[model samples]
Target: MPFDMIGGRTFYAYNSHFKNIMLKCFRKLSTSSSLMDKRYIPRRAVLYVPGSDERKLKKIPSLSADCIVMDCEDGVALSKKEDARSTIHQILQSQAIDFSGKDCSVRFNSVDSGLCEDDMKEILSASHLPATVHLPKVESPQQLEWFAGKMKDILKNSNLSEKLRLIIFTESASSLLDLPAICRRGVELSKDSPFKLDGIVFGSDDYCADIGATRTNEAKELSFARQYVVTVAKAFKLQAIDIVYINYKDLDGLKVQSEEGAGMGFTGKQVIHPGQVPVVQAAFSPRPEKVEWAADLVKAFEEHQRAGKGAFTFRGHMIDMPLLLQARNILQMASHS
Candidate 1:
């Protein structure tokens, strides 16, 4: 709030303690290891294809993204909203695209926007359905509840074999603040619901606009919000999606940003361009060195536990429960990647 839109230095200066704040946030993040033991689908690179773009839509089946989001929200223009919905509906119904081994999603307008009903109506007309629906700009738990009820009413009689998963965007101050409550509430309602809350995607551009955070080349302005979203999302056993790299032409910069997000524990990234998918996919994957370490650690952990060994030092670091869980996660990722 203290800086101009293009001036990020003044903003960072005021929030200089964000590093410490992020550290504190992460220190309190880990929950029971049983949460980590649950099966999670890989969402390493979430590629958003505008529903109105026929060229991109035709090529969607060829893209190797872990998740494909047929977007009818921000990516579509107001004038083409109906057209986008029609196009997406046709694609799903026609089976023009083979989405085997990949997760498909549709991004509807925010629940508050009055356009979500139209989006739902389009989906209802189709016999086919996406595995996920992305809800952008959802700031409160009530909105999530509303969507759940609305979706149940609309899709109750549909012949969907899989329960649809919902992913919300965390790009506003209110969203960042009430995120935990939203997830907790969603988790509660999900136990018996037709649709479930699955993950949170960070929309940095809208978030910065909402909070008046100045722009930065490397997005340092979004550092705290980014890390905080990942921490809270993981705490509630939900996948955390990192912000999109707007400069699609710069694959190198995108790689750095993607890797940074991965190191921060984001399970996936939002990609707008085809070129960015492979970079993000590789960035989110386990490296060979790390995989070897994880493999060795898993063996050590198994042996030590079988031999009645408690927390012991491995490679000069304490192999506690959290690290052991992390090691297991790495191995799982290694096998999947």
Candidate 2:
């Protein structure tokens, strides 16, 4: 039944309905963008560039890391720390260190350490800063909080007006014991009603040493810490990056480590050499089959919902709410990648 109306009233009603639909669609699109920008709980690959290495500094813009980290910590010698800091500053100043659509970060030594303070001063003094500043050897949220305050003051004084970010490296026994609580602090910081922590990376080698594990490339002894890191990162929805592969010359070793990390639910692994970038990228990038399967699940779930179904069967197995969430997440990772 239609109500009687003035001339051209039906056309006006149709136009109004179409506009409402368009508005709804637009809202969903905006939400999707936010989701895309939110860092993945599992960062598949992060490339580590030694800040002192002029050769590596020159190549940052073109690297394929999902997130790139310029290291001014363990990667550089004590005498070379200043050189690395100066190099990083010049690089950020003279040329654009494009992330190639990747998240960019810089690793300063422990904030409590003099070297790290100097590193921070150098970076904060720069007109341009990396997207995130990684604080190595973080043992607790308090350390993060302290570092956040320092960075805030620096950014304010510098008048950079930029949101200097924070990423903590958990490599000590104390850090391992407090991983979960610290991650919650990260979420709290990120919400930043006050201060926010951006992410946490597992400092694999150092962590292993702290735990009295043997120094080996096998990574067998690091299982507990590594798994705990991934779990905490997911629980708090912070990016969890893997440890760096130190053997720069062994591409095969890099591949092995990258694959292992990927299988262990790590979204990304750190690379010591530019040559290792492609291997890491390939390992972390969503597999084609996974993308296809996820796409199918999404399509099927949407179709079932449209048909007034509460659930659906896929490949002879019942698909439920949890599985649907997983499918959606997979699609999200694929899209983000």
Candidate 3:
């Protein structure tokens, strides 16, 4: 006897809940000739903006990062938390800002943190909202569940699309221990809607401190956590973000780490400063030789397929299905950039 009241029409909830019925109704009402096929693009760069910094907020529209995270969690001081929240709200209303097409986001304090409620309320009030939400210091699945519920409530009440996404930062030992399960939670949340469970960011600085390790150029102590996060993310088909390189003045160090992260399968890196953006971009961009190899693979594969062959060899080496797929991916990435 479940029902919904819509514009004076009472519809049976069971029929509405039925997938086949819903699909028919959607098709009958849809006016578009073509289906909406939205593809997921990997976020290549995410720049962090301290919430309390007016200077940074003013410069956001001019910034060239794929995503911009207005951080109200770690970046703001205790005395400035309220002020930061105010600034975020004001920025949303300001006529000067428009992050519509960008993968704009905000990192709220962890649900366990007392500031989460206020942070959520402030974000919900923004007229110009972000496309995704970054959750910091997530140590357990329960925290993920709680935040998901809160986001759902916000969507329903605000009349905004519920396609909000979650990008978690695994910063603690407990979080690193359950990286695989955490990624699973994201997939589960995205089950029935465009709303997504996106990525897991490895917070290297906090991770090292939690494990009693120090930040070094080698990053030997953080290697296990870094590699584990990337593995779990790939398993779930989610984005794996590398940690931010802290030394702003050390462009060489940043480039080296960015290269290492890219070679290790990380899709992107967290940039702490504007100076690091070009370095990360350069590292992530496909090289000329790799791009050329990808082009050759595609040509060879097409020819083999035309000849009724399932596989082909290229460059005097044995090339197979998996390598062909990899080459195509590399080519696609290069073309997109």
Best candidate, lDDT-wise?
1
Candidate scoring better on lDDT of 2 and 3? 3
| Candidate 3 lDDT by residue in tens digits, 254-297 | 87998999999998899988777767766776665665566666
RMSD of 1: 10.7
lDDT of 1 at 245: 90
- Candidate 2 at 182: error in angstroms? 1.7
lDDT of 2 by residue, 154-194 (tens): 76645434355566788888888898877777667665422
lDDT per model vs. reference? 0.78, 0.68, 0.73
TM-score of 2: 0.75
Native-to-model Cα distance after best TM-score fit, residue 214 in candidate 2, in Å: 1.2
Error of 2 at 138 (Å): 0.2
Deviating ranges (above 4 Å) for candidate 1:
1-38, 289-332
For lDDT, candidate 1 versus 3, the one ahead is 1
Q: How much is the lDDT of residue 135 in candidate 1?
A: 88
Q: Please tell me which predicted candidate would have the highest TM-score against the true structure.
A: 1
